[model samples]
Target: MIQPDYIFECSWEVCNKVGGIYTVLSTKARTLQQQFPDHILFIGPDLGHAGQAAEFDEDTTLYADWRRTTAAAGLPVRIGRWRVPGAPLVMLVDYRQLFSHKNELFYEMWESFGVDSSQAYGDYDESCIFAAATGRVIESFYRFHHLESQRVVAHFDEWMLGFGLLHLRKYTPRIATLFTTHATTIGRSIAGNNKPLYGYMSGYNGDGMAAELHVEAKHSVEKKAAHFADCFTTVSEITAVECRQLLDKAPDVVTPNGFEPDFVPTPDRYPARRADARQRLLRAASALYGQTFDSDDTFLVSISGRYEYRNKGIDVFIDAMNRLRTSADLPRAVVAFVLIPAWVYAPRADLKATLEHGAPTTAPLPTPFLTHWLHRMDDDRVSNFILHAGFNTTDGERLKIVFVPCYLDGRDGIFDTPYYDLLIGMDATLYPSYYEPWGYTPLESVAFGIPTVTTDLAGFGRWAQTVVSGRDITEGVAVVHRTDDNYAAVVNESAGALLSLMRCSDAERSTIAAHCQSLAARAEWERFITYYYTAFNHALTAAARRADA
Candidate 1:
């Protein structure tokens, strides 16, 4: 097997928990550590206030010489260990300095690589500036250590880091470059705009769609990066199709995301941990609704991810919950939580008071469905949907929907528990994603022995189909067939899947939970990390050929 002496992985989410990419890198770090040890390094944009970044443990002594030289040469960075499983070495670059050279960098990219920066807006400039800075940091370190002759790999994740890969390829030609697009800019935009992405994928022109969706600059950079990188990869086969059609480049590898099981409780302690999680979740729901829940009888379900109403199927999840409420055959009282983070203003004062002290009144709180107060309460889609759907915590209702607008970082006032802690309590999870590159929520749910319902539209859901047959929750995951025009059918199928889970006998439920764990075991980093090694080898061989040429 071919191996790089040093690997440098760059992503916007490194040490900064924004999305699923954070989970990917953080979890994969330990496995990569086992293979590469101190030879691997992660690069990320500094969060400005170092004190605010709790995940980074700065170690000034580890790279003092390199830091001093890099700082002297105009690039300042914080050398540290990410507070993840492996505690891998990391460099948080202060990319703000590069903003001054934004135009120069963009022009250089355009002139050299044909990366069109003329129509860039929003986060394009910020992302590219940081990406270019990462390139410079890698170049500085490579030169500082005289690693030109050594086998080295520079891996950049997502379109946000596309410029970094291009920069690295241009400046550090000896370093093998790999670029991974979790989801194509144009593909995501097409889905987000309510277009029939899958149905008309082949007919869609990447550049034309980019112009129509006002994502030309991001598409341009992403497409060029895919073509320029020595090895280009994506998270899943579904996304590989999107990359081929939308980006005009087939991925060299489909590097699926994998979970690190270190955080999951041991078999001996899982029961107690699960019980505690259930208690906390029920307590929060009870506080929000001012009604105590029978822990044994209540079925807990959740839908969480980025608050993309249509793309993440937040709308479908809400509609499905609404459908469940009207079902006469509903086996148990359902408490469905919308755990997506939004512009949370603060924890609900009344909910907090109720959780701290006993509920003064048994009646539902003013907005019985919300656990936290959103900044724009009136305009928030989830809040508006709950209101319009007439969802309520009525005394005899069969279903209750609670929207948690805050990130569950264990300090979000209410739960005081991390996301994974609460995740273990879920009886089932639903992620009927319309455009997920790789759905992590469903995967995480199953990893915790929770049966999940996702749709065929998701990359993870498709992967699940390969692992197990049939669309049954008993098989650990139920991948409902979803299409652009099948919103109603998807909602009904999701509701049916939840009902099926709720109706499972104790023995059957236990078996299903075991199945969930068994399925998740197949997706561990130990198995999936080989694809990354394959990508590294491809990049290295390509780089060698470039050198020869």
Candidate 2:
């Protein structure tokens, strides 16, 4: 039971909600805090803006003394607590002060660790500066406290912070380093570019692919950090294979992402919350299409996550909805919502007016398919797909697709409800991902007792197989097998799975929902957090070995 006396976790997403890594850290924070208490510290870049106030509640007095010491050491930090379920201790550092030293730092990284920053562009420089600044913060903290004998572990998440791990290795050798890549840059790039990743994964040289795809700098730092760290880890078994093939280093352990259901409403409050969500969803649909849908019979289905059209299976989801609409012997009215966030100009004024009026509409609202108007409707993939399919949200259509292009943070103008609030109202979710390292959306859906249809390509779908062991969609998780060429088959399977759920009796649906929640319990941090300890131990043990050597 080798334990870290202090755990310093750093990520670009800490308190900065950009993507899935934020959920991974924020959800797991409470469990880690319980074990380590105040010893667990999270570090993130403090982009000087007002938006951080919502997620980070700063407490200058909490670390006033140490913060002063860090300031004197040339590293100014905002000591605070992340405003999440755990409310863990967080230090958001202003790394912009180090921008002048960026070139010198990049030069040092290139000379010392062979990290090629010459080809870096876009956010590459900013991420590197932040990473180096984060490392300096840890170094200063260690020296200020004079805890050389402490078993300290500094964990870096994703390639964005890989340079920090290298920084720690060169300057603060006493701190055990662990680097976890949630997804490889080259792998995601290959998928995004419509290149076949899995088929040619064996022959693909990581460096070559990175150069060709113009992600050389990120891949360079990440690959080097993977080899240089005391412990290299990834989030899932599927990603481990990616690390081995792409990064050229097999992970020491797999730390699967876990969730906490603390936000789940109490048993007594469940029905009311669900009913409220259903009413809001129905109201929005009625306002858009001008026809009231039966709340009890209308099946609420959704697909939510980052707007990755092909990667997150948004394209396939639309295809399935199209298939369901055109098929015969349909069971119920299906209202599908594409809840993924996109670049929105503003909330549709007509939709807002309709929602506020609280009246069912029969005439279609202008641009009825989308809840919000986007800046570049011409370039929007989802909108283009819906239009290309020639499906409109007319009163005669059985299936309707509502594109919510804004974050549902209870103030998206249309829903006025947070994601979880709306998620609970869903009868089923479809996340037939083509390149999901670990599908958090589907996991969240199942956690809320909404049965989900996901492909085996997703890490969660693969892990669900072990939970029920040979049970099919009856277990509330329909795992569809998907390959590079199985696009049409996957769409058909997704549609068929939804049809099965619709055909299920009310009692059967309840049983399936119960089973969904049951499976979600197995994925809770209480059970899955043990793997994190494994990675921590590996990091500490490797550090001890290197120190002795």
Worst window of 10 by summed lDDT in candidate 1: 47-56
lDDT of 1 at 422: 90
Model 1 spans > 4 angstroms off: none
Model 2 per-residue lDDT at 401 = 83
lDDT for model 1 comes to 0.90
Residue-wise C-alpha lDDT for candidate 2, range 1-549, written one tens digit per residue: 688999999999898877889889999999999989989999998876545443788887886888898788677899888888878999988887788888899999999999999999998998889899999999888987987999999999988898889998998888999999988999889888888877788998999999999999999999999999999998878888989999999999888889999878878999999999999888888788877889999998999999878989999999999999888877899899999899989899998987777766778887778999999899999999999988886666788888898888877777888889999999999999989999899889889898999988899988998887523566989999888788999999999999988998999999998998899999999899899888889999998998889
**Every candidate's CA RMSD:** 1.2, 1.3
lDDT of each: 0.90, 0.89
Query: Per-residue lDDT tens digits of candidate 1, residues 350-388?
Result: 889888886545778888888888887899988998889
Give residue 281's lDDT in candidate 1 (0 to 100): 88
After superposing candidate 2 on the true structure, give the runs of residues whose Cα lies further than 4 Å from its correct spot. Answer: 469-471
